[model samples]
Target: MKKNQEIKKSLAEILELPKDIVLDIPKITMVGNLQLYIENHKGILEYSNTRIRINTKSGVLRVIGKNLLLKSIVVEEMVIVGEIHQVEFTD
Candidate 1:
């Protein structure tokens, strides 16, 4: 698996392709501390007013903050809105 990942990374760099798309990884985007956009996620693991855990291809993405809300969810992406304080990943 690691070898395959390395090959994909090399190919993406050599071809000037987007790594997230090439590697099938989650693309995380934040708008200030109020909103977050996660693309290519597997699913939502846990959610609450103060915390959210999302399943991604690489690992579990944990979002911590206040007044958290799942603003949007689709097959390929999710939008989280609130006062985001921290984000972490764990395998």
Candidate 2:
């Protein structure tokens, strides 16, 4: 496999996620601090600003915070910053 593909595979294995799930794309953008329906959304370990949750097909981006500011939001792109209180994901 190529380097990027290998990396993605490694991440999927590390995350214990199914390959299909790990490759799912986001449908919605900037629900909150979260990117919706993002499958291979790795590399986020610290979420002190705002809580975020994305949905399948990248349809929804849910964010929870005291005062949130979404700098930009698109169907598959988003940015959020603010005082975050809690973050969770729902199925």
Best by the lDDT measure: 1
- What TM-score quantifies how close candidate 1 is to the native fold? 0.95
- What's the CA error at residue 28 for candidate 1, in Å? 0.8
Model 2: which ten-residue window has the lowest total lDDT? 37-46
Question: How displaced is residue 76 in candidate 1, in Å?
Answer: 0.3
lDDT tens string, model 1, 7-91? 9999999999999999999999999999999999999989999999999988999999999999999999999999999999988
Q: How far is candidate 1 from the true structure (C-alpha RMSD, Å)?
A: 0.8
In terms of TM-score, the best-performing candidate is 1
- Clashes per candidate, residues 3 or more apart or on different chains: 0, 12
Q: Listing every candidate in turn, what is its Cα RMSD in Å to the true structure after a full C-alpha superposition?
A: 0.8, 10.4
- Mind giving the per-residue lDDT tens digits that candidate 2 earns over 1-91? 4587678778998999876656554323334433332333322323434455544432344556755554555554555656555545544
